[model samples]
Target: MPKMNIKKYTKNYFMPPKIDMSWAFKEYPDKAPVWCSVDLRDGNQALVIPMSLDEKIEFYKMLLKIGFKEIEVGFPAASETEYEFLRTLVERDLIPDDVTVQVLTQAREHIIKRTFEALDGVKNAIVHVYNSTSVAQREQVFKKSKDDIKKIAVNGAIMLKELTEKAGQKYRFEYSPESFTGTEIDYACEVCNDVLDIWQPTAERKAIINLPSTVQMSMAHVYATQIAYVSQHLKYRDNVVLSLHPHNDRGTGVADSEMGILAGADRIEGTLFGNGERTGNADIVTIAMNMAALGIDPQLDFSNMPEIINLYESVTRMHVYDRQPYSGSLVFAAFSGSHQDAIAKGMKWRAEKKPAHWTVPYLLIDPKDIGREYDGDVIRINSQSGKGGVGYIMEQKYGLDMPKKMREDFSYRIKDVSDHKHKELLPDEIYKIFHDVYVNVEKPLALIDFKLDKTADGMRNGTVHLYSGGKEKVLPAHGNGRLDAVSNALQKELGINYSNLIYSEHAMEIGSTSRAMAYIGITGKDGKTAWGAGMDTDIITASVKALISAVNRLQQ
Candidate 1:
């Protein structure tokens, strides 16, 4: 064999610029988006730490509070736990009158019977039936012919229609061609038409043919084309509600759902925060917020999103990633210098105008809409960050007039640390790091000694001494708990009378022995608020330091 020399070659890659969504906004300008939560079904099934019945109930209530008119509670026939949850919902009359709960089941006799048993005595329900219709699904999963799947779907639809008619229940029927996105268009239409023929939904009671991208296999445009094709071809299309349920395997779930709507889908099935199997389903929060950005009200009441997020985090035990779209902690956070500068300017622009126009320099949607406070801390610096972030923090927190040189120096320091840490700095932590690096000073309040004692009668007492402002103050107090006693003693020494000051402490570093950070929110006598923080190896000391910081702020 002759020896051949191979030369290395590199090719330049160029991608198209992202399209302006103004056209979409203009085309679908007026119609209010329909939202359906698949939390109890899709979200529950996806969670590694599944919700208990009580947790499910709590989550269901939170969904209602968030103003979802339609919710898929669960596949009642799938498990006794699910059936019991549905039964509990019915028994307690927990579902809101206007809201409709949906139950999913295969097109089978026994499952449908169990589904009905679960829906017994429930008010306002939708019986969602589905069967695998794609060639791949039928051949791979069921090992059946297309005709067999069609018969099964038609039989299921007829059974549901008969059951609803005989029982005189106010229920709607919905059918999904499972894996419809991958199915042959003709076969999908055939199966959907067969089910529609059996149910024979009238114009007044239109059946919903929910086309789901069970596994997101292509781009959003492809899904839109599929949806449009189905909408155009389905028999008795006028008497049907075209619905879309898309998953997030490709990370295009939101775009796919929206494009499906544009392609004529009348309903959307998604989970809050896009919780589902694999990469999760479309996030209803992001979708609704997107609608709001288009000047269309999604008609959802997300006024208490923080509390809702807290509840969701607690029940699902799923941490909302800081970068997750709208609801994430860092969604509104700006770390880049240019971004922070633009946002700061935009905020000021909106503030100066009466009846401010929401369209501003950098904000896509107003933070206040989702009950988020506009704080500088959301913008921070790191290696990939810039000067705008540092300047914004300085002006907002310390009211410092940072010169350009100071900003450049700060930016360099931030970059140095960020490069070393290999991550962006949080706003609070950035300030702390900056203080430690540059503005090194003696401790403002030094904790000299503290002692906690509990009597045999279970009474708790503590004493705390601290040196601050050139004076050593000692105070003693009793409380129901050691931490409470310490807090009371500190309060007395500082003459700080705050109402309902709550202290939450959490470990910031890794491992059980790592130091912890304490966050303290104090409601002042004037009913306004301020937050203080401390860090220490001991949790109690950290909390005490945080409380002292709060008191010091009050004194200032």
Candidate 2:
């Protein structure tokens, strides 16, 4: 083994917040923050294959359908295709009156003018301008001081204001201290206040002062503290919408956005599934769903989540991980034996008790609320399964009612094959296994013929014929019940002995014309148990066939 030096990296905390941030702990967002999706802009730019103009239009329609009143479309001046896309929206009058389109640009002169040109006839628009003010950018990238960076932001805000006045339009403005998390707190506040002075925001024309964790350099709590300091010190607090745009460098974009919201930030800007540059932006789906779970209306409609995921993946040329929160294929799936058992019991309890709230043990929210079913999605059967989950699936899928002990016995058979194959068994495969192994089977001891006659004491006398050793034999017997009477005839005729019969039955279909299924378990003289199932149009026949199947299994 070779030893290598590991002290090549160290912590660098460039920004220090001025406030103590005790108020962040005392308040949590009771309502959903104002949401702005930057999917078509920030998210699309990061894709290896960016969306075409037509695809961007399709995605924009989807966002509108999902109840987004404010959608940041794209940067018009960045590319000719982007410029055409915005022109198409305006020229064709595709934007709705309720929705406002926003476009992003830097603090440069020509870029800011061309960005407004794309929103020529828009009903409502936001001209979003940003500048890099972090210590690293000032030192290395731009080689400028704090005063020069402040000039960029102030001049951009003035240009936005002048353009709106010259065009005789009422377009809102947004300013971002691009790397807000890395910029010194007092300097960042001073620049934002200067922009606020230039824009002169009011209750009717609110300016968005977006604070972005562009490179997420610290913990979520630290970001929240920084947001709290800015929230307290910013000028014209009532007229400014403090927005948070968090990237996932530390894998805590969601945490930073949530904590920022708790610290008095009023808006959230991100992509649908956190699709953006580097580690990507905060996932708006997760943040919104979190709000919904907390009894707050997320304002956005995610009811048909599968449709949203399909469209997002199709347009973005990206694949959503199977384990992604709330929208993944396996988000609601429970694979562990203990988790499945608890969920099964909880479902039964909710059905019978009819509780007011969703209280499934392993589930945080009712999956059906998002269009997922419990049968296939919940209670997955594999090597790590138990009787409760198997029994639940059997009952839900095929309407089979197995006794508790028999269910336990059948679970082992299912797990045996699944473990041998090293895979999870689907519902149809499990059903076929049950049918082939236990259903009314006739083998070495096939039923030949039987005759029954009623007696005076409610007992039935029976005569049964069977071929045991390639020869036919006749025997007569009597017992208290029909099954018992048949059992007596089989024992007497075939010299087979068994006792302690347990039986259950249920209607496989709904009406009187429906077929019935019966399950039976019996113990033989060797102290071993056998199980069976049978289906017939008549209940009595089903029971008789079930007993015959159990006897054959015992013999084998």
Candidate 3:
């Protein structure tokens, strides 16, 4: 070979174009889907900070208010707390007339007996029993053969049939072949058939064969195929309410559940925000909301979804990820300039027409349906962001239009800051930075004097004076933060005491000069909690505005 210096040309990397989502316009039937919230059992068990009995009761009340017919309260056989919670519901007659409380148990005599003990006086209940039947689970976990597992499942079903009959209880029987997703189709069918034979479900009484994707280890389409196959081959197909429970190990729980529904599953088993063991179960909120958007009645009153999300987060101590499907903070939020423009236009379109049909350009579902206010400032400009986002924020915040030149200048500045700080710019914080860079405001509430001192005896003295409305108010008080000092000073000047006040702050931007937004929760003498919010370049000013807003709310 000749010694020739040859250079190879490199191919340029090109990003694929985005696909249009107009296919969602196809009409689908409006059948109401059944929803089962495993929050008490699955969600609480998965939480690092589990809900107390009182919190569980509060959540149960909320679920009832939301019109849930069936709620899996808890595994009563698991612990004394769970047992007592179930007992309290029964003793107090808290279970509503229409609603049914569901309890889970393994296919064991003692466990089922304990579950029955917990449900002694319940008006309506369902006992969900399950056992490992798959080859992997049977051979590995149970160390049992296929015939052995089937015999156990049949015996368990017969026992439940007799138990419910003897007690004269209005109970429904449900069985799950644990790890059915990986089980041999024929074996699973045989096990389920044997159980159905023992139970002998009538036309009115259908047994729910809950097939759970206990671990999401495969693609969504594969799970759907498995569900379709099982649904087609189940022995008593018409007498069975096919159910699905998918976990989110591979982050496709929602997709798996939805496809499973399409593949013939009638009931869903999941937790709010996908809380469960391992990577958590599928999120019922997301699945229900998605179905609602698809023109199917998901049978959930998510009108106060924000409150529900907040309560779940508070009680469970599990935050919903920003990118999580419908319930996420950023699901309806947009950051691209084009996306913001489209969403803004979509809101305007929705103002003129009913949103029954999915005709909005950018929004997949109406934000109003889920208690989210229309966001005009969905886009912003930064190093990685575009002019759409920045322009939206500018126009929405100050009613200022960004001229072509100003847009470019502000875009470059945002990009520079973003690159330097390595974080996205918040709309409010970006507004403040823009105000400092381009607009100037005279100090409205300038601090004149402030002092905090402690005596040798450990008594603390705090005083603050501020210039406001052309008057100087010097008031002495005692409290925590400088913002609290200022609030107390104002309270003293106004002759008001805001004793039940809680304040929280969030940095709106990154780095040293970032602005902060404050949220204040105030409890009135009338026993009402009012929320107020404020944003400012100075954290102290933000807190002051929030406090003032809280006071204003009290007046209202």
Could you tell me every candidate's TM-score relative to the true structure?
0.70, 0.96, 0.69
lDDT winner between candidates 2 and 3? 2
- Candidate 1, clashing residue pairs? none
Model 1 spans with C-alpha error above 4 angstroms? 1-26, 353-356, 383-387, 402-556
Of 1 and 2, which scores higher on lDDT? 2
> Residue 465 of candidate 3: its Cα lDDT?
69
- Root-mean-square deviation of candidate 3: 17.8
Give the candidate number with the greatest TM-score.
2
Model 2 TM-score relative to the real fold = 0.96
Backbone atom clashes (below 3 Å) for every candidate = 0, 0, 6
- Write candidate 3's Cα lDDT for 37-60 as tens digits: 888998888878789998999888
Task: Estimate the TM-score for candidate 1.
Answer: 0.70
Q: Can you rank all candidates by TM-score, best first?
A: 2, 1, 3
Clashing pairs in 2: none
Candidate 2 lDDT by residue in tens digits, 1-556: 9777679755544545567667666645779998999999999999999999899999999999989988998999998999999999998888999999999988777887888788888989988999999988999999999999899889888988987799888999999999887888888989999999999999999999999989998999888888888899999999999999999999999999999998889999999989999999999999999888878898998988889989999999998889888888888887777788798889989999999887789788888887788898888899988888898888877778789999999999999999999999998899999999998777766656666788998988977665555677666868897778878887876788998999998888433438999998899999989998778887878888888889889999
lDDT of 1 at 27: 63
> lDDT ranking from best to worst?
2, 1, 3
What residue runs in model 3 are displaced by over 4 Å at the alpha carbon?
A: 1-30, 345-361, 380-387, 397-556
Lowest summed-lDDT stretch of 10 residues in model 3?
A: 11-20
